[model samples]
Target: MSRLKLALFALIFLAACRTVPPPAQPHSGFTAEQQAVLRQIGFQPKGDQWEFGIADRFLFATDESRLMAAQKDSLAHTATALVNVGIVSARVEGHTDNTGTARHNEKLSLERAAAVADALAQGGMQRNRLIVRGLGFRFPVESNATPEGRRENRRVVIIVTPEAVA
Candidate 1:
């Protein structure tokens, strides 16, 4: 075959072998690092907006009014990007310090998830694409025996699943 024809044949063969990237793998669930984020958020997602609380976890609490502060902007961006790429649905889980009663922790976790979800929304995600849940003291990253452990236990976690995006 002529050089040009040979080149064309090779190109066609390569193109035929190239398949659409397999539909992205379904999200298996949260990773260890992401679970660490839950330790930071202090809650977990059971479904949509409901939040459960974990007493023995440490979570960072910030104001909803300033939810988009630079510190969390990168996370917001990443989560949004994943959603935009049709890779996953965003999950915001919240938790709280064990400084309060079980009821209080539950409520606090829900608030924290809502706060993060709000930040994500501000970053351009549709509200329907967000799932928020709070787990109060039901799941602990560390034992709540000591003050430090308690501090570590209060947190919120974000879990993204690919199935949502598909």
Candidate 2:
């Protein structure tokens, strides 16, 4: 009986001596500020990406890499939002319609992407955080046969990942 009691006491003591780990912190998808910025910028979550349609004023003219004043202002807001959300990295994809030659389209796309990257950098986003890709006439969201579709295809897409968020 004494041996049994000793064994029980030993087990109890060992259990008591075991260390308890700290509780894990709760994780929300995004910060309030980030959410607010997303809302302000009118971006909707689409699958794994956030999609933002460039307003008419921000739309790039054909074969042009220059940004309008309003476009710059809009990009500045986007940059501020990205900074607020603690995005560590992002890909800026530039796409062009099939109107021009493939080589011309590719060059134009690259130039447009670079222009956006420059604008974002000017808006205070770290240049290192931005990756520029020019898709040319590839990866069209709509059929390039129609004018409207071509217009929709000529766009810049900013891709962000969950791992990118701090």
Candidate 3:
């Protein structure tokens, strides 16, 4: 995409997100340092997991699977912090809105998760410690009837644990 298109896309996404209410900030059992990392890296800390939404912090263009430059930087920071705080593993889950075929959505979601996991690896987390999954659009945080709700539904939710999950 050209610079103008990219800028316009970001502006449009940001404007669209402005009307949506922010999700509640939920803290998990993570140490203070870990919590701080999550916040600083743009995740809304939820107990046992955190939400990295496409709203305000947009990750990709509609149906676009690659990570934006800023997203990579944020994930890198998160990965470093997770390592420092002794988080052994994470299930990096990718999600999408209900606008595409289930199969395509599932594949896109998985690709997005792998992208996130790759970013984490670049930041210091071991690749083997990360598991990626695509839940598709089946598990939405909001209704799919409206634009704002759909925007909120496009997200990456990470579940961190002390031990690796099979």
Candidate 4:
């Protein structure tokens, strides 16, 4: 009886010590429609945000904030897609290479972000739904020591949040 009681106690203790996985978090950010839109616009998912690289139709000229004709068309398509997906708001973050002074980079980044935001607005997205930010050379995805990396660093990231979709 004593041996049986000890075995039962051990079994109970082992069962109590068994690990249980935590509840799964509900999916956030991009909805199905939004994801479709992102795909259509050629935006790649980078973690929580979406990136439109220079390889896509969203390239910016060297040290320039003006959108090229192709870039404008891309923005238009993106705007239409965003509307279709019911995504009412987005945060546009502009980044640049570390070649320029911090102040200059900041200003240039802001200009680039504003240019993109304006293009989106013209494409039919409401101005109120867009928030522009210039991060300058603060967040570089690659080392700025290489030309390719520098080019990659000069980019605009569109961040979609649950609140934006909601």
Candidate 5:
């Protein structure tokens, strides 16, 4: 009877011992000011979905040269703002009007995204801090049926987030 009681007590003690996962580490990237912008922009880290943005003025440009300048400036500002807060990495997504062919638009969108990424790098962002993507006309914010709306739809969005620090 004594042996059986000791065995049960040992089993219970062993069962009570458990290994808990380490707590989530603090995010290490953005400055305080930039962090505020991220919070305002609704950047949540729980899921795969992240928020990005595009400028209204950039879409109104008629020539590629004009578009390039606006895109560069926009991305630079975006990166600066994010880095200031704590963003260590970002993804730039480019969108365009439906007036062009799919292939042409696709290439143009990628170029636009790359241009933005370059601008971000110039603004003190690191080389590995960015990822560029071009969605073309497939993901339009506004209807492409009208010239005005199409212009508004052509843009690049920057998604910001901090690097993983264990």
Candidate 6:
């Protein structure tokens, strides 16, 4: 009886001694420092991509692709951050509200993207690593029916590709 009791106790001890696996790390390609820097500068993580953006009103006047002086400064700082972190590839995309013909919007959005890409290049990011696109009303973040929604739709998005931080 004593031997049986001791055996049962040993079995229970073994069952209770399970080693829990370590906590799972986030599935992100960026290092902790890079993530911190991006988050601090208003970039948000979407899966493996990091995105930063602002509405068109803040950066451009009505139908104008030229970025304001202050907006240029802001984007330069953002580009500097990317260069500092050794980001290898980034895409600068422009979007516009559906307030005009698709052809017009497409041209305007492309100009906007080019303007932003130029700013980043001026701030020391390699020109070759920058990809520019003009989505034009085709990928609105909000409805075009309301003024507020239209404003939201007129924006630029910068996405750091997975190739970044290499």
TM-score of each: 0.56, 0.72, 0.69, 0.76, 0.63, 0.79
How many angstroms is residue 119 displaced in model 3 relative to the true structure, after the best TM-score fit? 0.5
TM-score of model number 4 = 0.76
Candidate 3 deviant stretches above 4 angstroms: 1-58
Q: How accurate locally, in lDDT, is each candidate? A: 0.60, 0.74, 0.77, 0.78, 0.67, 0.80
How many residue pairs clash in all the candidates, one count each?
Answer: 34, 0, 1, 0, 8, 0
Write candidate 1's Cα lDDT for 1-166 as tens digits.
5999999999999999988787876443655555444435443545432133544222564222124366367556655554454534566777655666789778877887777777766667766777788887787777777877766665666655434632
Clashing pairs in 5: 29-86, 30-85, 30-86, 31-84, 31-85, 31-86, 34-85, 35-85
Clashing pairs in 3: 26-45
Better of 2 and 4 by TM-score: 4
Off by over 4 Å in 5: 1-34, 39-74, 162-166
Q: What clash pairs does model 4 have?
A: none
lDDT of model 5 at position 27: 56
lDDT of 4 at 28: 45
By lDDT, is 3 or 6 better?
Answer: 6
Instruction: Estimate, for each residue in 1-166, the C-alpha lDDT of model 6 and write its tens digit.
Output: 9999999999999989978789997778777888888888888888889887453223344587888788888878888987788775688888888988999999999889888888888888887788889988898878889988887877778888557422
Best by lDDT: 6
Question: How do the residues 1-166 of candidate 5 rate in per-residue lDDT, one tens digit apiece?
Answer: 9999999999998888966679986653555566567656545443433455343334534324134565567657766766666665777777788877999888878877777777778877886767888888898888988987788767777665555312
User: lDDT tens string, model 4, 1-166?
Assistant: 9999999999999999999999987564778778777767777676666666446634455587787887878787788787777876778888888997999999988888888888888888897889999999999888989988888888877666656532
Clashes of 6: 0
The better candidate by lDDT, 1 or 2, is: 2
Query: Residue by residue across 45-105, what tens digits does model 3's lDDT show?
Result: 5546665534434344568788888888878887887788776578888888999899998
